[model samples]
Target: MNTGAVVRLTEATGVGRAVVGGKAAVLAELSVAGFAVPAGFVVTGAAPDDPELGGWMAEEAARLGGPRFAVRSSAAAEDLPDASYAGLYETRLDVPADRLAAAVRECFAAADSPRVADYRRNRGGDAAAMAVLVQVMVDAVAAGVAFTAHPLTGDRRQTVVTATQGFGEALVSGQAIGEEWLSTGHRATLSRRGPARVLTARQAEEVADLARLVAERYDGPQDVEWAIDRDGRLWLLQARPMTALPPPVSWAVPGPGLWMRNFRLGEWLPEPGTPLFATWLLPLLEAGYLDGMQATVGVRVPFRWTLVNGWYYNAPPVPSAALLVRVLRDGRRRAVTILFHALVQVGRDPAAADRAVLSALDRQWREQELPRYRRLVTVAAAEDPAADPRRLAEIVDQLGRHAGIALWYLAIVGGSAWKMEACLTRFARRHLAEVLPDADGGAQILLRGLSGAAPAFDAHAVLSADWYHPVAAELPTITAVTQSGDDRQSALAVARTAAEQRCAAALADRPRRLAQFETLLRVTQRYTVIREQQARTFTLAWPVLRRCARRLGQHLAEIGAISAIDDVFFCTRPELDTTATTDHAALTSAVAERREQWERQRRIAAPLTLGHPPRLIGDVIERTVQRARPAGTTAEHGSEVIVGHPASAGQATGPVRIITDPRDFPTFAGGDVLVARATAPAWTPLFARAAAVVTDGGTLAAHASLVAREYGIPAVVGTGNATSRLHSGQRVTVNGTDGTVTVHP
Candidate 1:
């Protein structure tokens, strides 16, 4: 135990990593810190040809009381922040004291081995600057590695341990499978139980504690190797920095209430949402609802409207009563000021506020926004407009403005529709459950009665036509008016019967309440129609914009600014703007690089909540209305049963048809269960042919839910990963009322 060419592991402090190497430095540090490390000596410098090395080994053997020792390569580059040589280096185990010098020489010579050279070349490391560590090897009862954090999930709160019997080298070298355990605080759970349990619960906790300590000392996660001797004594063999940890996620909830992804917005944004869409377009839509609440109730409720993982999340605002009170007071004062102004200007125009709301709803998009869009399209369709950069710039400006107008109105209609739907749902839950029995049935009855009044019904009819297509310049009209009229009459008759049967008892018992409910229901229907109209109108603009983008893309391709026309989507708006003046080679390279990055992003699942979703609190009406089912509904007993919100009520079993794009529609056969990431208005036509509907994102008021209710197909929405989980042609049973999809093996 002396400081020489070979220093005792415990006494080797202040020795630089370049001399004793990264592994020796860590071991020495652990020994100095009073961790249970084995007696060892580090042979510093190059190959251990020194005559003193043999004498030092003999002295170490006498102090440790054993001839057997493990000689390990500890290169300067090993266990560094960027490089963990790991199994790439040599380890000669159970070397006799006489062969210790030869073992050290062999360990050093491993630096020049072909495999080590290849590994260094691949990992971009220098040739190993050799040092050899000789230690009194433990005869292990159980041995393995532990991580202070969940490596894959990057969950810092948990420690993961992988253990197997015998040497940890077997597990590390992938020669043996191991049992896995995840520990947090005093709790430890076995994730994978191997043939034999390697460690007891208490032992696992002890290991986790030690690992956590090492990780803390290192100021990051640590990959620790440990051995539990037959006598139950724990020994630390190696500890190094964990490499390539995923970036730590900030798990703070956006607000005080749980934020969930809504399919209404998510369906429209099927791919990863772009910043422009999330920042510019989505906020405008969210503001419409927030503003509407302020106008109607004198309460300016805030919303954390954001995109998480490219999906839209409806986050509740801060739960501050003082903030709410202040907003209410301001809203009330503003309302009083408006009322007084209206009285002064028009001598008590009582309906001024109503007129104002009506005006907002009735603004003529066709007269103002659509005309500009049309003009742009007309100009862009003409030959070689690249010569006129100013004209193109004007068209781009017009396109953005027009799209904004469309989005603004769409948000207004959508937000209003959601409010109305929530009201209806709340009323049904409070009053109509006893009479209707089935909430989905009741909704269908009400919806069918108002079918003639909903533009969505007409739109569905047009969409149902065999030749109908979304990108068509003009939507097809119902040419067979007589047949449509007959179909409507039949549907109305059925709807009337269903409604009468459901509402008769309620109406008889509470006539006034029934009348009030009827009025609300009618208003809800009107809002629903407006929502569908705005969605359809807004969608029409997409084809126009898409055409323009493609045109520009084609021009860029001609100038060699991109590999293909579709590559334009990979470029940001500003990058696309540069195409007007930037050099072709630079633009092309940028687009190609961006395309690669975009493809990589598409593969990652975006977290539903940026941080942990906020905890539920208070008696918020939104929470009550959004519940998919009554409390204490028993979960279906099956491993394959996927739970989701019951959007539409029915039961059906069919082969799954996973549709990510409309282009995949032809693959959908009748009686197939449609499994989609989300569904847009454009996807409505598929409902008519599908036996059941399952979506990754949506709520009761989402387009898929509404359409599913209309089609009377069983639907479970907001499954979060239905498209990924359910494979095409896999048979499954969907229970919409139970909100479960049982996959068949």
Candidate 2:
């Protein structure tokens, strides 16, 4: 029974699941479920070199009508709901009949590989229980992998297909790029990247349709491999539950006007917001923004926002005659900062506004606005979060407004850093280009700030710096280097002093421009420090908010309405509002469903913008200023190069150390090239030890850019696909001067 047992694929029943393993059993179930599955046989409890197995395999291959066979391992540890050992075991494709035994042996032997051993140790229950599946290899002209849900965006309404001209191994192994097709309601669109069209529109739909059926059979979203043969007949090869899927979220733009996520408040929120955050904190923050606007600009833009796919998308209503009239009527006495901002917006001279706005707003913020916010946070945080709903709501509202006003203060007034830096850049490009070797990136050196560490690096002040807020470990990380702050401070002072001496020489003959240049450089440096100082405290109110949310969750869980304390985050505001009277079972089910959707949303590669794009104040300044538009790409050394925005000005060569999850922070070593999709405020400490910084997403003024500048490391930001193109341990030369990341092949 152990050496010679062999079973026909068509005859293997669902009852044979334990005997044959998940992969083989699923294929048999798919056949019974009327899905198109290629005929295959399972060698159950038999050695690959068995004498009877050789005769049985030869007989089955002849009966199966195959010019070639595929030998795949069906280990018991594979394709389980809890774990999917994808690509860990061997799958020998296009095997000849004579070599089938060898392929089978290889498949069986792969169970002992180090990769699988490591995986087993981590996941456990990997007992090397395996059954080899030998099947007739279909003559595929095109092949691909399909996800019943949009894997990247966690959009359950959309199915994604990655197809190629031949075997799917190329696409899966990253050896070749494929045509990315997205199907929504029978209509499909292909991505502009990758090769020419491989799958016809109808073929992609067919693949998606089959994938949906597979998901339906499995009662969850499925990752399925499929192939379309020369005759256009489709065959299902394998199916498994999609692993680590983000929570499902909708992408449809809510209401009208332009909407974006990575700007404004969205910049700090890198992942989908939980229900409580979206409902309670977001509105309060928005209100605070309105307050900041009123205080600084004395006008309202009537900005509104909503959660699209669990991410905030704010929209400033497009201006009409009516909107303009309302704004004029609503306008208060414009603060000095806003008055200066208007001058820049209209392309007028801003020398006068610059001097007044910078001094006036800074004094006003330090004296009145900041103190008020500090008072609000200090007072409210001291309150009991477990108080009655009304008191808790009031406390939440007060904290939210305080935090939001902090953002507008930075955007409206502290934002002068951008203008000041541009002024310095234009001056350098026109006057100091001959003196400064790297003219395009000269502004970075000038804006390294006056201090090494600002209040922005304080972990105690910004709890949301971790992104996961309540969930992240409280153990301090990245901020420990404050003890050696003097070294970092001295580095900045030296860089600034050197750049200034060069600039002073360039400004010698021209008294008018020279005086103006000094003013711009000083403010640019000061504002660089100011930006982080404000950013560090932008989420100061988050701790109190989290406590309130957890307190509510604890109450709900204790009453058996939700499964866990954190499940309260998944319930919508209205649902939570009515929780006092709502049915416990209904609320419980809603939390479970929504929690899964929120988790799935984390995987989506959210677009930078949605709806129509709007021109903002920063765009106006760029148009008015004579600036150096640095080149993003250049060929060098025949290596893979990634083009991005030049952030920090320095150069360093080292192996890449990509940190995606906060848990991976401990794995990082000193002097490595820090690679990430983006870095948050809490990620600043790593920059102290980093040789260079490379991010998939960010701008010159973003958190990563600001921190990298403070540490004086080479940085390339906004290389949209760097995380996928670059991997850990790869040697790379980061050229911050040119804004390029070059891989050493």
Candidate 3:
């Protein structure tokens, strides 16, 4: 062979076999196997010594009508039975016609890198001359990397090939990893099927056939890269030996406790009842913890009745704690609308709107705020502190209470998120059927709209014109309307700006405070952290026992009847009639099956499980807890009232109309009081007509509270269950000052 001349793998390997690497050798073998092989010239190690070889190869590539060929590295010493030096060198895809020579040279350099040398040394090989393979790129119909035996478990009975759309390089280069399967070595075509997807029947046979050819020629098990062109012919571009095999074992989970070791709860929450409360308490005290979550974190939780019954399953599961902390530090910043919605729900009225807003806020707090807060608390507590003994004691006490409050909040938020998702889905199913054919994507659509403040409210116009103001007539007018109104317009505008500033300040502070609480929660909940710290010989602080009763009251604004569970492990589906406007029968059955599965999946330690009969466990648990009550056990006056958090700094009274859902819109006349659990994107339609809004959960930044303020209506939020606390038609005064609701009996 001429040292500077380029030759086809077929030509060179057929006559001069020692010139190229295993990759080109396999291509030559495939060419001989009656498979379609692209025209390619192999430039051997002679190119490195003779500069003229580069120009000759480029000229040759130009002669072949160079659209772009793959310039891949093929080291003569590589792709042996003991090692496949994959990805140690370079493969430049779609190289330009003029740049083919340069690309080939770069591959030569890469193949000669220290990494390649180290790999060769470790795998018991010598650095030898490299070959440059320049091939006409095939317009691949399908492409993948195949193994003759299972690389993971070393099962020779199965051959695995993971295919993806477009080029197969992505699969090899770690840009993408394809779906895989175990096959009986049959050559069946692959197709997408249901949730499991990628059904490859008989494809295994084709893989094995290829593998058999490789083993016959190369005398060992080979890792092969194959591609099918538009003409329906399989061509093997490269093949190498398997390095090592996994010890055989049954990998599938065999009932309970089989793969329990794999579960990582640290990614989700802190372990319950850890003595380290210091790490969990601080974020609860952060001001910004609640509001900025939706904006800072993606994935809003839905809080509604229908969703309460929906199955809670996160696909592919969240990352481990280490990964989450990394993600938090990395580039996945949350969308703007999420933050906006989160801010809106921060201190807004939860009762005035439907269940949707309540759910969203709850979800934000739980998933985003809580996780970060937990990490923060954990890290902070582990660090040195210089606080006085009394102050430290007080802080410990505060942390304990904070954990309790967080737990309660999380439960409420989780329940609300599930319900909201279901409610929106059901709404889309029943009402938006004409508009939306597929209800599956409804929640996503709803969330998109809700995230944006799509529906604007004209609060100033309403208040000025007394047009849609429910409390317009309720305000007492002085004789001759001499209301001491000097520069009323400017003063009102200035005052409003100042008030808005204060609200904005409060909104901004939520995330930080939330971080504090979340950290403490994490420290308290994670047993692993405690053990890990202890093993490191770190001092574990004694937990301060705070009154759970007071903390529970503070966290839960309103408590309805509470059910005690004799067995927390066993869950039940409650029965409801058609009057509840739900498909309860279908839901209960679905939930029952799901609950059992989830419990199995969760697999709480045996110590945590109560040895009660499964059927009676649900009801008995419900009966054991004290009836849920809101904070403050003061006597109630018989009156119509709407109670909520002090979102806006003022309150106005008007006619009360109790609405349990967003569908109860027709009953709400303009200026009539709107009462509900929470608001959602769909519930914005009613914001224009309501006088003032009230809710059980929310900060000043909540959706209803924002719309109420924007629409110039007074709002109260975080009153717990505003609807449950306030009667239908009773007259009462909402005291925004000191955050109280008083009734005029």
Candidate 4:
């Protein structure tokens, strides 16, 4: 095998990896396959010390008709299936022809660089043979890297492209930020961490097309480097097998069963959930719902739930024997069983179920739970964790139990409320169309009328005070109850006036069904108020749990089980349980690994449902949510509108204030349209000052919805990406009645 020291990349036939190296071989193959690779030649390790290499370089440069050349390292170990020596070796670009030989030597020398050596060692590879690839430099207007499959989440249907202006070096070296484009096919969606876009939609799709071609040719997903020259010709700079491809994802097609996401428990848990929390919390929740169903319906239906990309999702339950028998007897029963299991579980009477659940909650609140929770809150506040760790743990346990009970009722409340609303909407639309033409309008009127009776309004007023500025701390001991009383009275007065006016208009001229309408109104108000009260009460456990977790975190940090107190969040419950009393190096490593995983998960757009997330511009629903602008408009200009469920009935246009973390609460200004992943009860205070609200996750019965309705502000919930799509200072008009948010340029 007397292969020459130098080989023309286009004519490098039968060149082995050991000679031409992995990258040069791939380029050679691509060039042969007719890809738009810049004309280049490879200089093997045999030529690294050859004095005549300079003559060869000049000939190649002249043949390519370029004064500047790119000298890139193509080590044998580079771009391996298991490892990508990306940015570990030297790549010298825009080198004058006179310095091409020196650049080649520099590229060859990169094989011995400490970083490359360490990288290879880590991957269990021996020293790599160096081959330098010299190509005519393409003066790029834009350059970037693209993956045929989504680099994260491993969705093969999507292509992820990241590009920046001028050169790829800036993006590769992390010196400058770049715009990201996700291309599914012909359509491309553009997103930016910073405010500049380097590639247009057409350009992005073109780049993605080239990448897909490379991947198809290679017979697997490819990580491709691409550039567009000043004349607008797309060029493939390099291509390599994608390393560490995510395991194949099996997406479930939408089916007949009930698929729940961004509703009930989903709204409260906005981030990618920690494993420990998911392990303990999800099962308990499932059990609670199961118990409720068993108690009400006398049959056990599986209430299975799972986390997809860290978001809670309830999987469609397996049909029970009773359900199957019912289906055989009546087709309508099957539809009802699949769609409205909550109603079926509660004897198929939503109003009765509402009454039963609300009555039980009222009794519990009055007899035992409310007083016990209040006393515990006082004890938790008064006794410092540092002074009494045992007592602190005991209080945390008690708080958890209280929260669990509340959650059980919340499950009932959420299900019953949804069923009740569905029934009410159906009845109003069918029977009361002449009296209340808009079913939603009729429901809104009833909700508003019931608002005056809600204790949640009083809680909101009390929470709005300065003492509650830091909600994470234990509630302050009220030295004087008069201020809260006066605020409550004022709130009640305002609510009562609004309710009376709204109810009068709703009931005006409905003489035939007056009594029935009034009965419906009373039931709707009672359940709606109870829903709000239970949700608020359930959240009280969160601050306590958070504090307990922090304390545990501190203990771990003091004992050197983890590096920091907050790192405890990254550990699994089992890991925490075992490592709490013992110090282990693996625990630290695991925490660090989990932190990285969490950071990556943050970048992923979790699918709205477990199976197949809606794809917009080739990316999953999660990734596209932030980048989604109104259709048929560019980011700089367009009348892009986002549609969601209208939770509150009003309309307002204002600058958006994107709040991802509660710590940013202080920065919220009066009248700013609040945008977040989701809002909890702790977020109630912001609603008071917000002109409108938009969220990526929530339902008509979500905390944000209830609060927004009470505040009489426009709110659109479950926009699925409002937090990611809308930026602070951008003006958006939120129409709660229409459930649409139109972004203004």
Q: State the displacement of the C-alpha of residue 510, model 1, in Å, after optimal TM-score superposition.
A: 4.7
RMSD of each: 10.5, 7.8, 25.0, 8.3
Candidate-wise lDDT, in order: 0.64, 0.71, 0.44, 0.67
Candidate 4 structure, TM-score to reference: 0.70
- Please, what are the lDDT tens digits per residue for candidate 3 over residues 1-745? 3344466666655634357776777677677776556777888877677758756776677767758788898777667665767789889888877788788889988976899889888867766767888888766766677776666446666666666555689878877645443355364332111112222355435655776667567665567777776776666767777776553323332222211110111111111211111123322322122223324354333211100111111112222576555444542554333333333332132222223344455455546645654554454354315443344435544443344334334333322332233333343344344443331222122222121222332211111110111111222221122222223323434553453343334435577633433332222112112221111111111112222222221222222111221111111212111213445345445445544443332221111111222342232212211111112322232223333344433455676666653235556666666665445323444656666666544443344544444344555654544554454564445544224455444
Sliding window of 10 residues with minimal summed lDDT for model 4: 460-469
* Higher-scoring candidate on TM-score, 2 or 3: 2
Question: Quick one: ranking by TM-score, best first?
Answer: 2, 4, 1, 3
Residue 203 lDDT (model 1): 87
Ranking by lDDT: 2, 4, 1, 3
Candidate 3, after superposition: displacement of residue 566 in Å?
A: 37
For all candidates, what are the clash counts? 1, 10, 98, 5
* lDDT (10s digit) by residue, model 2, range 1-745: 1223677777776446667878888888898788899998888655654677788788888888899988898877778877889889998999999998888878888888899999999986647568888889988888889999877666788888888887888887778767676789977665422444587678888999999989988899999999989999999999988887766655677765566565567666767787767777777788888887776777767577777777666766675788667656666435433644633631233345555565677778879988887787777767755486667767777777877888887776555555556666666777777665563347667766466334244434432422235422254554334324457657776877888888888889988878877866665677667677777767666666677767777777887878888788777767766877899899888778877777766656666556654444324212321133443434242225677767776678999887876557666777899998777766766776788999866666667777787777888876755765566877888888667887774
TM-score for each model:
0.57, 0.74, 0.35, 0.70
Candidate 2: segments with Cα more than 4 A from true spot: 1-56, 59-149, 152-250, 253-257, 332-351, 385-389, 452-456, 461-468, 471-473, 477-485, 614-628, 631-641
Mark the 10 consecutive residues where model 1 has the least summed lDDT. Answer: 460-469
Evaluated with lDDT, which candidate comes out highest?
Answer: 2
lDDT by residue (tens digit), candidate 1, 1-745:
5545777887777777788888998999999998999888888873355667677778777787766888898888988767787788789987888888788888877888888888889987667567889999898889999999777546788898888998888888888767777798757765544445578777888899999999889998999999998899999999998886665434455555556556334445545554334443345445544544454436555556655444456655655778657765776765445323322321122124224452344354435654665565456446224534345435544554554455555554343554555556556667787765453454444654344333242332222111112343233322211112234435744864666567756777898878767766666666565566666665443444444556666767777778887766555556666676877777668767655544444444444443443354643323433454554564453335787777777789999888764556666777899988667665665676688999877666667776676566788887766665556777889988768898775
Task: List candidate 1 segments past 4 Å from native.
Answer: 1-267, 274-390, 426-435, 449-493, 501-510, 579-590, 611-640, 729-731, 743-745
Q: Candidate 3, 14: how far from true, in Å? A: 5.0
